[model samples]
Target: MNQQNHFALGLITLIIFLFLLGPLAIIFVASFEPTSVLQFPPTGFSLEWYRNIFTVSAFMDTFKLSMFISFLGNLCALLLGIPAAYALSRFDFRGKGLLNAIFVSPILIPGTVLGFTFLRYLIVSYSLPLEAALFIGHTILMLPFIIRVIASSMANFDFSIEEAAMNLGSSRIGAFFRVIIPNIKSGIIAGVLIAFLESFNNVDISVFLTGPGLSTLPIQMLTYVEHYFDPTVAAISVLLMIFTAVFMFLIERLVGLSHFTKR
Candidate 1:
């Protein structure tokens, strides 16, 4: 690209980033305010808000609930996503395009539709546990992302490594573990991380499925925000953002962000 074009592109990108992050930046800064109401350019700063976060029994309970649910959701997505990805990447069958479309279309479907569809199924036919329903619904939402990540990784991996391992007397499972896995480790790790993140941040599905005596952090935050608008929510938002950033940073350091791409 020419210098002028590059400069213009950079300016546009900066504007976009600022637009996206400005509200979040304001929330983070206001979170430390030593006041009752959420405000910007605070009169003072203190750790009291975070301390208050710890004292809230509801926040702790909801945080744990979110962690547990996200874990289960990611597990289910991986169990189903990995094999489906392998099939789509490694083997071609009749109606392959149709099957692939069905698998991935969930990603394009709106979260509201996904939530309402699962809610209807649970209410009418299955009558499944709310937690299980949430798990399944989140899997529907996140599974496509996982499968696509894994498949993209698989595409970039050379199959000859697996063939070589098999030819050298490794068992099928052994070859997969010792050869294929190591080669595709980055993709799998990225998929798992992204799946966990998507599952963690889910609201639409969880909000619909959650009943009395159960709530995730996002639901709790939504409820809390509805009832009271204040810097406490901002405190929680900053904490959540920090936690996610640190986690993603660790993963990127270990696995390398490049691993997430087929290139």
Candidate 2:
């Protein structure tokens, strides 16, 4: 009976994986079609659509902008998130509960609502640049996930090691950098992957923050799809899937996927 139950669970998991990844597989196949229109079974395989992705100058610029924003936003999120998670997990203070809730509040709020609020506050109230506002907005969106992942990693960590480092004459800051961070390195990498992907793929918040010149790759794809229906978008999607898969493989290789889960 136990073996039968295990088999059933494995079957269900496989079905779910296929359901989620089916469209991506379809898009990958469609991207290679020789014909201008998107079709599953290509009349003949060609890389024309993939090559066409570069022909659109906006795609290149937006891709660069997306990479820039995601890198900065994810970095900022990590810088803030690591310390925030450490404090929340290691310290006790007044309003700690409130502060923890607030740190992760962005995840609970609707992205569209957050975007609209940022638009009003950043532009109407303070007149900040679109790029600056977008950076801030993406960082806010990324923080909760980073904090949550790192905090969970830290929860299972043994604090005695940090204390041991301090007893050996290491300052508190030094102990953290030398001891605690290395222990939670897996969580940091996982958080970075999640945060960067979220920032890169975000569309709702980016839509509000984007202007005439600055736009993310996702927004650019949306704009292109609005006017055109070619396989170039699928080609782009395939490339992004490859990019994301490469990162995931790296994460698995460096940290092992099991580190993300609680023991």
Candidate 3:
């Protein structure tokens, strides 16, 4: 019976892995197809679609925009979230629950609703630029992840370290920078990478926020698929998969991925 149970568990695990990775495997293989259209079991293989990704001006432009928004939005989220997380973890304050709820509300809300709300209240009412709106929207979307991750990292932290630093002539701010920040470095890095990934791959919010002369790579990919059907998008997807895998691998190397699961 134990052997039978083990076989069943192994079968389920194999199925789960295939379910997650099947489409990506298909895309990777289809990307090398010589033909313009994406298809499985290619008759011929070539790098044409991959080369086409670079030649397309829209892809290039939006790729840069996506990178810019992702990096900057994650940066802003970290700047704000670190302090916010520290406060929530360390201090007792009135409305702390309410503030925590507000911080996390973005992730809880559906992306479509969040996007429309931002469009109506933040963009239309304030008359903000598309770039500014995109930045703000992405920043908000990133806040929950950043705050939660950093706060989780701080859950097991020893406050006495900060107290000791303060006792040794470090100001509260200096102690935070020198002591607290270093202790939570792993979480901070993980949060930034996760936030960057979210902001970069965002579509529902970005679709609403984008306008002429401003677009993200995911948005561009959507628009591209609307006008054309080809392996170019597949090639792009494959490249993005590689990029994300590399990014996560680096994060794991810098700070073991287990850090997130632990605290």
Candidate 4:
């Protein structure tokens, strides 16, 4: 009976994995198709489409813009989120629950609603530039994720060590910098990865925030698909997959992906 149950679970896992990976497998093959249209079972294979992505000026600029926004906005999120998470984990303060709910509320809201709110609040009210609008929006969206990840790590942390340090010679701030931060390094790294990806791939928020000169790569890809139907996008998708794989590989190497997976 146990053997049968184990077999059933294994079969279920295989089916789910295949279901998720099937489309990605098709796209990987489609990207190499020499013809213009994206199709399975290509007549021939060529690197032409991959080469074509670079020739498009907007793709290059938009890619750079996406990377910049994702990295910088995530950095700001970490700067704000780490301290916020630490405080929430360590201290008792007035309105702590309310503040925690507010900090994490964005994760519960739909991205489209948040985007519209930002447009009305920042652009219409404050007349902020597109760049600033996007940066701030991404940072806000990132905060909840960063806070959650780091906060989980903090929960498992041994606060006694920090207290011991403080009882000795270290100031509270010094104890945090020297001991607490090092202990939670895995969570910080995980948060950085998750936040950067969210910022890069976000569409609903970025759609409203984009202006005349500034557009994220995902939005740019949408616009490209509207005017053109070809394997160029597939090629781009393959490249993004490769980029994501490399990033994940590095994350696994540095901190072990299990850090994020474990409760």
Error of 3 at 240 (Å): 0.4
Candidate 3 least-lDDT 10 residues: 254-263
Better of 2 and 3 by TM-score: 3
Per-residue lDDT tens digits of candidate 1, residues 8-55?
999999999999999989988899888888888887988888888888
* Tens-digit lDDT track of model 4 for 183-243: 9888788788877878888999999999778999999999999998889999999988888
Q: Which residue pairs show collisions in model 1?
A: none
Ten-residue segment with the worst summed lDDT in candidate 4?
A: 254-263
**Per-residue lDDT for 80-103 in model 2, tens only?**
999999999999999999999999
Candidate 2: deviation at residue 173, Å? 1.2
**What lDDT score goes with residue 223 in model 2?**
91
Global lDDT of model 4: 0.91
User: Which regions in candidate 3 have their CA more than 4 angstroms from the true location?
Assistant: 261-263
Show pairs that collide, candidate 2.
none
